[model samples]
Target chain A: MLEKSLKGNLGYWAWVLFLLGIIGVGVICYIVQYNYGLGATGMSRDVTWGIYISQFTFLVGVAAGGLMLVLPYYLHHYKDFARITILGEFMAIASVAMCMLFIMADLGQPMRALNVVLHPTPNSMLFYDMIVLSGYLFLNVVCGWVVLHSEYKGIKYPNWVKPFIYISIPWAVSIHTVTAFLYCGLPGRHFWLTAILAPRFLASAFAAGPCLLMVIALIMKRTTKFDIGRVAQDKLVTIIGYAALLNFFFLGCEIFVAYYSTIPGHMHTLDYLYFGLADHATGQVYNNLVPFMLSSVVMGFAGIGLIFVSRYLKSDPLLALSCLLIFVSFWIDKGLGLVLGGFVPNGLEQITEYVPTFVELGITAGVWATGFFIITVLYKIAISVKLENEKTA
Target chain B: MDSSRRKFLKIAGITAVAGIGAPSALNMLMKQEVQASSAGDGHGAQPAAHGGEGGHGAAPVGKRYGMVIDAVKFHENPGMAEKCIEACHSYYNVPDFGNKKDEIKWLWQVPFTNAFPGDESHYKKDDRTHAMQFMVLCNHCDNPPCVRACPTKATFKNADGMVMMDFHRCIGCRFCMAACPYGARSFNWRDPRGSKDGVPFIKKVNPEFPTRMRGVVEKCSFCDLRVKRGLIPLCVEATGDSKAMVFGDLNDPNSEISQVLKARFTIQRKPSLGTMPSVFYII
Candidate 1:
């Protein structure tokens, strides 16, 4: 199975070479930043967090996608998902790996990260997030490798792996929950202070992650001999449909809480994001997020609408388009709106917009390329095993 | 159903429930342990309370130090503002990036509009003449959100109620910056010992206090060092005779800060948020 990744066709080699190219450029940029200091990036006193932290948040949710398959299979004993559970677990491993890399990139002194362990502070939400994320990563590596190895060998999975599989179900939820706690518990950031933040994070993660799983499954169907079957595909569509609705419902709840409460703290971030700040209407200042957030909202609603239409939903192109919309919508929401919303009209009520430098974008692309590369190699192994099983059948 | 089946169900059910409750429960217990350990005078591992040791501490023990500012005095005598800022920045070695976008500040003045926002009727006589600029610093909050947010106990409150920073321990996550209600914390975007054009950025490093590295958060120390030596905060001393800034113990009735708080109409920033900022403005 491991050899399968090495002996891929020319197209696979090309993909691996492409990802390697990104890593090369990113390493050069990282060296410049490491020597010059954080001043090399566009981050300042006001907008401390930038695209790095934003991507970290989004990927944590992406990593949580594994549970969609795990929950259905184990908790409900839904045999349909049993075939694809390994796919979700493998994706979790890649996504979590990316999540860790993004956090390391965001750190000012990445070397000093050991201080979190040397002097632990449990009260800090980050302490908990780090613990859970690392723990979850370990769980997935053990569970995913063992399960996949057993399948490739055409043998029953060892009984010892059961506890890890079960532990990962709840551990998956904890990782995302702790990630939300990182934002929501902050005092001054009105955008993320809501108690519903964890639920909202989980909901969006469910939609985006499984939607990704569906994309992967669809790709495998086309490119390889492995398919998850029509029944599982329909089940995933249903999962995406309901999860998208729940994600939007939770978002609506956030809007209602912010508007009805009339606390300027709560309303400010949303107002700045969705509707352009009227204060900026002096025509002097501009809230650039307005257009991006508006597009996200429109696409989000459209994605949800398309998911409900049975005729359109049944079509592969339509479903893929719908998932693409949902993916882009949440990606922008978490990336630009949620992360930057907390910073604009910053703690001092001063408007300081953050614009990332080219160097920052290069580093971000490198991180994404690394993630995609991991996903490709892992899926290659997964599909080869699936093909072998099919041949045996 | 065999005995093994019933035993498996019992163990699995308990494990599920414990796993769900463990994180929050562990968090609560850790918080209690932390609070219990750092009970009196937030910093220091002196097993006993203040009276047990360090009894001859120059700054009064068991007292939260606070400051009251006469906005009018500083507004009228503008030189006092410069002197005060120079005194604090020089003492702390806070970098002067010479650009507003990259500005690093410890104590600085903000216009009344930005400082005490949403209060339209702040100035009765004239906006320009009456309390135009207000000085702001770390609150040394009663419930310091920054302290809670710091994963390392790098930034902590001392027994004297001054917020302290352990530069070596901070991982530079900037979580404290997000948690603070007032924009008090600043990260070293560039090295404070900056190298400029093949020359040393800092020609003469302040030897009295050690300079910090590029990857840590720093803020107003409330002049804890001077207070330990029984001297007033440098800002208060530098303002000279006019006494633009008054620093004293809030707990002692005889202390100047307490007396000023009782006598004048003073206001702290964002008191409604319950951060209990120790810096107050005397209108």
Candidate 2:
């Protein structure tokens, strides 16, 4: 039995080594970016923000997804979520770690990020975002630890912990909404200059965040002997389907308001993002790549269709595939769509194209790997804790 | 519960400290009072100004610096704008070349029609070769939005009407960049101060308005450093008394900027924005 437990541990070690090798290469590229500056990235005057910011935006939703799972389980008393809630908390910790890394990569003077805490600007949405993100990170970590310990002992949580669990429910929604406010509150950007952007971010997060959680559940089921109950998995899928539906509806409303009003400023952003505008005269695009217009339409419909299909929802592989597609679709919509759309057609109203550099791509990869590495370590520790509890029982 | 109690006590102690400290600080800093309706009212019109120089306290004598550009003349002599812009950029240590993502610009000319869209235009040209007239510098508005948006109060309007950015205190959130209607703000995406070596006679920088590092937002200060030293703006000096770039007290009737505006048919950029821009131009 001991040999079985220890058997081929070298494989796990080698897998970690491979991850580290990729991380090492990413680190070398990141150093090059630091030496040369953000100019090493795809960012340009017309497109001042790029992949780093978009990735940060995308991850905030993913991190929030963990909370959405936990809140309904603990607060709403959904005992079906008991098995998977630890996974949710673990996912949150990883996703938040990634969100922070991506943000730090985008800063011009990465060292000065510490100054944000020392000299907090209360008026700026960024200040509030820092507070909420750090707070949620701490809350999930502590709560997850406590709950996992309780489960090991086969004991119920003390009455006091429930209140804290309840607080985290809404607090999770606040994280992505505030991030949306960071972009949408800015006055001049015609694409982001809307009040509905925050709600849309929350809707998309719910849609994409839970879908990712479902896939993570499936991955664990495939690799590990630990059996995640099918009922629990089905409930998670249903939640994701409903969230995606809301996300699609909200997106449709945004398009409706833009096209129906006939305001050139409002409509221009939609025309560029969804429908390709005339070549280069006024639009942010030069050759009209039509990345957003087509990607959003195809993936968005596919996501909605999969959610509505009973067989796709029931099948683990189809469910995982649909979740992966929806996640990618939203990532493109939020990351590429929101950021690129804001900048296209420079402030001077001139059209200039932006392309990302290799160094920028490398740093972004490093950030993503770091986030994954963090999750892997945390989940390992959590599983160890669970196993230790089972042994005592 | 323990943390909340600690937090509560901390807040109460701070309030107590503030209550005890405020009166004495106020007395030492501002003892004299004048019959003014609000703080925004003209302090110059106050009765007992203060102890420093006559009744008016140690309040600074501020000049509401302005520019009255003749766009018609600039249309002919494009070289005038180029010279003025170069002077401002060199004085401020703006970087010359970088990716558009990281470009730092203190003062550069933008086309007038682009600068102020929806204005009444008598001249229109379809010729592909013809360029529109350009306005060269910061508007330095009366109610400057940059001043309001700055989190650290780093960008502030001086008693004398110039809007200045205190580089030392700036944390560089770039909110001021978003707030400016004219798109006047620029962020230092790379080390802008390193570019200062090429400019002659601008060797040292003041810590109060230090040479900015990467990632701080900067804009035209209307040459506040020149004003503090009692010199006219570098741009105005470059104009050689042609009154091409006018600078003076907008408040004082006798000031050059006021005299020119009253005399000529002057127009401010995007007056509909209601920023009350100090800079004006004569077509």
Candidate 3:
């Protein structure tokens, strides 16, 4: 089964090599960052967290998004999803791996990361985040491997795998919820203090995660004999469509609460993100994220609208385009906008804009490449097993 | 085959439980031992005797330390805040990164509005009040968000009500930085002891205090080292006038800080957030 990844065409090897090249670049950049400290990145005292944290946050949702498929297929016995559940689990394994890497990259002392476990403070949300994420990663690895191995052996999956699959359903929700608690529980961070933050994270994650899987499924359909049946793909799109709507609705609720309350504390971060927050004394407006945030809102609606339309959903190219749009939209909202927006008009009401350095971008790209590499190999193996099973039958 | 699998599961379960349970049990034991030793040293036993007397020997424990800043007095005495900041930085060997981005500050000043953002009063009639700068530092809150956020107890609230940081244990996640409402903590973005163009970041080294390494969050430990040596914080010492900056036990009602709070109307920054800041400003 492991040898399945080793057997690939020229194109497959080329793609693998491309991912490896990006990873190599990332390793070099990380080495420089390791020596120079986080000072090598553009993050400052004001924006203590930047690209690394934002990516970690976004990827957590992508990882948890696997729950959408797992829950429906496993719990409801949705037969249409049976073919693609392995894909969701494998993607989750890869996404969780990236989330962990992003967290490590963000740490100022990467080596001391084990301290979180050694001297675990249950009170800290990060402590729980570490537990859930690693636990989810472990669950996905065990469940995916056991099920796939059993499938390769042409037998029913072991009964022991049932309880693990059942636990993973709720565990998925906990990972994102704990990640949200990391921000929402903090005092004086007006942007993330809202009660709906966890729900918002879940909604965006559901939308973005499945949308990404849909796009990947479409790509696999073109590239390989693996077709995650049209019915399953359409159902996934329906899930993504509703989740995107809910995500936007939550965003609207946040905006309404911020504006209707007329509290400067609640409204100031939003103002800075959408409409530049003006310094009353200096008459200087900080609106670095205004363009990105506004575009996110536009892309989110446009993407959701395209997917919801029956005509576009029927068209593969258009559906793929819509998914890419929604995925990018959520990426901006969660990956770029949310974290940066929270920090702007910082605790002292002074705005310091964050722009990631080339080194930061290189390292981020490296992490993404690593995730792709993992999924590429995992998917290749899954597809090979499926094809082999189909021929045998 | 079934028996072998069940046996493997049994061994794995024991290993897993031991792996997680051992450290936690040891941590609890270590905490109790520390408490027992401190209690034996009389630091935790007799709280009433060590109240504002600036007790000799080990710093007074089982006390809530607090600071009261006389804002009006600070305003009257120009350059007082600057001197205090200088004293704190020099004493602690806090590096000058030569730029605000990487700057490390234990104590600093911000404009009146910035210091007390909750005060939303518009159109200040007096230019003096408008232009006033308030000294700000770690609040060392009774409900410290940083302590609650630190995954490793690297930053913990001492029995004396001072928030202390163990630089060695800090994983540099910056969760404490995001958690701190006051923006009190600063991450060592670069090695504090390192040099640039043949010039050391810390011009004068303070042998008494350990300079921190790169990638650790640090802030005012309320001069924990100085306090342990039975001396007041450097900022309070720099002020020279006892009325300008008061430091004493909040638990002892007879203490100067407690007396100041009783006599004057003092405000803590972002009191609405309910951090219960130990530092108070007399407006």
Fraction of native A-B contacts kept, per candidate: 0.62, 0.24, 0.74
Q: Which stretches of candidate 1 lie over 4 Å from their true place?
A: A278-283, A310-313, B1-61, B118-131, B195-204
The digit string of per-residue lDDT tens for model 2 on A193-260 reads: 78888888888888787877777667756765455577777777678777777888888888898889
Worst 10 residues of 2 chain B by lDDT: B48-57
Ranked by DockQ, top first: 3, 1, 2
Q: Judging by DockQ, tell me the better candidate of 2 and 3.
A: 3
- Candidate 3 per-residue lDDT, tens place, B77-150, comes to 99999999999999889999899789889899888778877585722756776777789999988778898899
lDDT, residue A184, model 1: 89
Error of 3 at A309 (Å): 2.9
Q: Compared with the true structure, what per-residue lDDT tens digits does model 3 show for residues A304-381? A: 888867434478888888899999999999999899889877788878889999999999999999999999999999
Candidate 2 per-residue C-alpha lDDT over B36-134 given as tens digits, one digit per residue, 9 for 90 to 100: 334447655532222122212222344456677766666666688778877776766666653455666666666645555445253254332125566
Best by TM-score: 3
The single-chain TM-score for chain B of candidate 3 is 0.84
Question: RMSD in Å for candidate 2, one decimal?
Answer: 7.2
Q: Please give the DockQ score of every candidate, comma-separated.
A: 0.38, 0.22, 0.68
Query: Between the candidate structures 1 and 3, which one is better when assessed by DockQ?
Result: 3
